[model samples]
Target: MSSSVGPGDGSANRDAEFTETLKSVAGMANLTQSRQVIREIGSSVIQCAHDRTVSIIVARQVLDGLAGKLRSSGSDDTAEADAVVDIADYLLREINAQGQSSNLVDQTVGLCEVAATAFETKEEYTEAAQRLASIPLDESRRRVSPEDKVRVWIRIVRDYLEVDDSTAAEPYLNKAKGAIFDVNDAELNLHFKLSQARINDAKREFLAASASYHDISFSPKLAEEERLHTLTMAVRCAVLAPAGPSRARALGRLYKDERSVMLANDFSILEKMFLNRLLQPKEIKEFAETLQPHQLATTADGSTVLERAVIEHNLLGVSLVYNNIPIASLANLLGLSNDEAKTEAVAARMIEQGRLVGRIDQLKGMVWFEGGEASGQNGSGKTAAPVDKELRYWGANVQSLAEEVERVTAELQKQFPGFVEANLVV
Candidate 1:
């Protein structure tokens, strides 16, 4: 009972015990273990392949285990494919050892998913598209489900849109359209329409494009905020459509309904110009004389404040005598500087406004007011002063001034008889 083992005996016994434990565990477990265990084993297998005979068997086990894990995960197919690619180089090395072409084919075709995973990482969409295209349709139909195909097409379309080559993208667009229409899902349909709208815009088919744009406006599948954007595109297309007169009319009606003061004034000015060009000189003169005296005043001061009025009236008279020479040239005759001439011209504009005249025109060098009234003043009974001596001295002769004013007044009355009574005189 007092027996004691030596150091060598104790070492031998420990070795025996360790060997037995290894044997039991090795027999109890399958060739491949859990995913975590398999991953570790796969790493070891890669390391062992550098120098050990068990490398091929270990790599095979790792691949089988990883494939099983991928199948069970049911979601993360891409990640699963990526895991397979991690082992591809080792697998290829072993397959090369076999010296069989069929072995190479079997290995490559078996890991199509892995190839896809690696190809996608290249970020060359054209290459990915080519690889995907090379996979037998039947094999893809069996291996990747319809839902996966839809996802793939979505990715392809996104990539194609980035490239922005309409010719190269047409087939992808067609494929996406088919996938969208074939699927009965409302969400997918809306996505399809959105893509179609983009493609249609690229193709320059605005009418067909608008239809797709309109679909997204009320699509329940799209977010409310996104639907607003879609609605905007539809409205834009409707406004820009070149084919339909109805659309043009509708836009015109909307604009007219929303008329602002600025827009209304522009229209009024334009209409008066059109009518002025259409009417004869006698009619134009009649229209000018019909204006109230105060309407023609340069300032709001009473009619007797004659200097500003004379300056204004004489400016008009100079325009008539000099064939409506610009105010800058008239300024030169009056010995005023450019800025002074511009100021004088602007003052003349104020007088025209007071008279409710639309515009001043120089016909054959003589200036005439297009929509001027006879009284030449506003409702306050103010009248412009007679032609100033200074103005007459500056190349504006009395005879020419009187004749021009008379002629313009006659034209105004001829065009509008009662217009002068209604708007011009007190």
Candidate 2:
């Protein structure tokens, strides 16, 4: 008649058994045995445990078991990819469960990382980033410091950039920057700047992006590969830049750098061809044939950078030798077919972009270069008045300054809305 176990003791024994089962699952080496044990415990039992740490350990064990099976199989089966998706779903559920556990931030973040990596393996970059970004926005979180919160936000911005969706990336980038505003982490700063550069690039602001890349390329904190990649991007941006003093300076900086030689070998034949075109405009055609489709200027729609560079060089060459040239002849100099409308269209773009300091005469079918100032024909012909030229230049400067001020104001508002509004109120 000795012992009927008390209700409290019976509950305590079950809790201990559940905790021991978790430890056993974590330590299990035999994949088959681990799977069997998890099946025995069942989802209902595990969910009822309501212990975030136990959920994390079980999820990690399952992921490891799946990976071990794949490694041993030696052949990738479609079934394996499906298995990965299932595991990612499980991890996602675990993360949701842990949202209100203040002590489980690292485990929750780690589970999200695993899920993201799995999605990335399937080339679902946007989904991968979204999974991480969702953590910060979770309403159930017991506590998350802004600094800790930004860690996942940074990952979201990066993954969006991987898919070239800067429009979608913008909101997350803004969120990440706000969270890290008062934190002084060098790595986060670099990541933020890199995202900004990429966003500028996606927006087709090549000059500003080039400046950003150039600055990052010189950061002493960058790893070797990162520095090289940043420098390579800087060169690409410079080459794609519309013709101007800024483009000239960007090219000059690249040519003067010794690292440009390494870029020719490590990056692409495209780089070498581009460099040759810039330094010796005559070589544009010879190297132009080597450019692949991706080397094209993206904004120009299937037009290769080398082709545009050739047209630009021909324009510069003619400006030195002739006060004015027929549009057809200029097209011929650049090896363009004799299409009057097409040639004039190309010339018009260059002129409009200020790459060619000239005006296109459609009625005359000729382009005049700065009234022969470019050809030094002013010594042999007429010239615009120096006073008029100076005034026009200053007017352009005033317009440019106004545009830059407006851009800065918009950026400040985005980056520091509260401060901006407070200042405005004051």
Candidate 3:
């Protein structure tokens, strides 16, 4: 009484379906329609041969025909979209089962790439990443060029980033990093750098993320709007960075950037933070609205990252305006509660960490500001001290320092091999 046919009967019907499909495709007047119909075959009836190898050979020919042939037009055709994904997945399982065939592998790459694009368009990023990851990077089977591999891995990183999966994205990003230099395409390299920035941002390495975003903002290859958008992102990351000499220097670079002026909302906060001006609750609230969910994430201190950054930044701001302030009073000024001990602890930590450039007088319940117009961590009137801020690092995971070191080494290796080899490790 079951409606489902037995396996043998179903196989016969599928085989018949495949035979008729090819005939219908051969007689078709429109090449695009023929291709679209074929696009659905692997998902539906490509298994008609019953032999996995034979089916792959047939499916590969159809996919190869799809190569160099564009879709010609967009469609909301959900059925066609679903079929495209199914085709890729079918190839995926067969590829795993069968040993690598050079011809099949080559065509599989193209079809999988197309399927990945379809997934991305539908905003199914995890599926897109998996589709891209399934591509065979084994050079023994086929030629896998550096740029080609970088393109795929970077695309995977971008997909994982889209879904807020940094852990998943990191390995693919590292894969791309190894091949990025060999890629001559500026756009691809730009995206590689952007992906790194995105991961750092997700990981709360704001200083590092800001530096990359700031550098990218100056790329001449970017359109004006795109450049400005990156500039905006740079400012946000910089503002969210920890209050210290390194962060101060990073903020200075963005503040000095001419393009930063184009983004009024971002520029306003940038100016205030760079000048060490106290931020109001209203202003902070408005600026907070512009940040991404990750940017607004909570820290171990039970405060949003934005809240922590602002409080610490305001502490530095107040330090510049006053020679000394009581701990209770400092708490109120920093928008914290009437908790003098907690306020004093924050000051003490910043001073110990060389961020506040001050001395906390616990007995007197006062923080003696060391920077001026009050005194001068050189936390003073605008412009940071003309020192080599590039070498400064916060701690173990300061990603910016490593990146900056690499840039300098790459430049130095161009002309000074001895210095690079002796002092720097690539």
Winning model by TM-score: 3
Q: Candidate 1: misplaced stretches above 4 Å? A: 1-128, 140-147, 176-181, 245-426
TM-score on alpha carbons, each prediction: 0.35, 0.65, 0.74
How high is the CA lDDT of each candidate model?
0.44, 0.60, 0.73
Question: Model 3 residue 4 lDDT?
Answer: 35
lDDT tens per residue, model 2, 244-334: 4556666777767777677763234334433434234444444444333444544453456645654554555566667778878877766
Of candidates 2 and 1, the better by lDDT: 2
> Residue by residue across 1-426, what tens digits does model 1's lDDT show?
211223344434433443343334334233223334444443444443333323343344444444334333333345544444444434544544544223224233344444444545544456545545443334422455555556556555655655554556567667766556456667656666677776765665545665667656777777866775665454434333321223333234323432212333323322333222222234334433433232233444432222332333334334334433554565554333454534345434444334323232222222233323323333211234322123424545767789898898788889997886677653
Candidate scoring better on TM-score of 1 and 3: 3
Candidate 1's TM-score reads 0.35
| Candidate 2, poorest ten consecutive residues by summed lDDT | 373-382
List the candidate 2 regions with Cα displacement exceeding 4 Å.
1-10, 30-42, 49-85, 91-110, 121-124, 138-140, 163-167, 265-306, 371-426
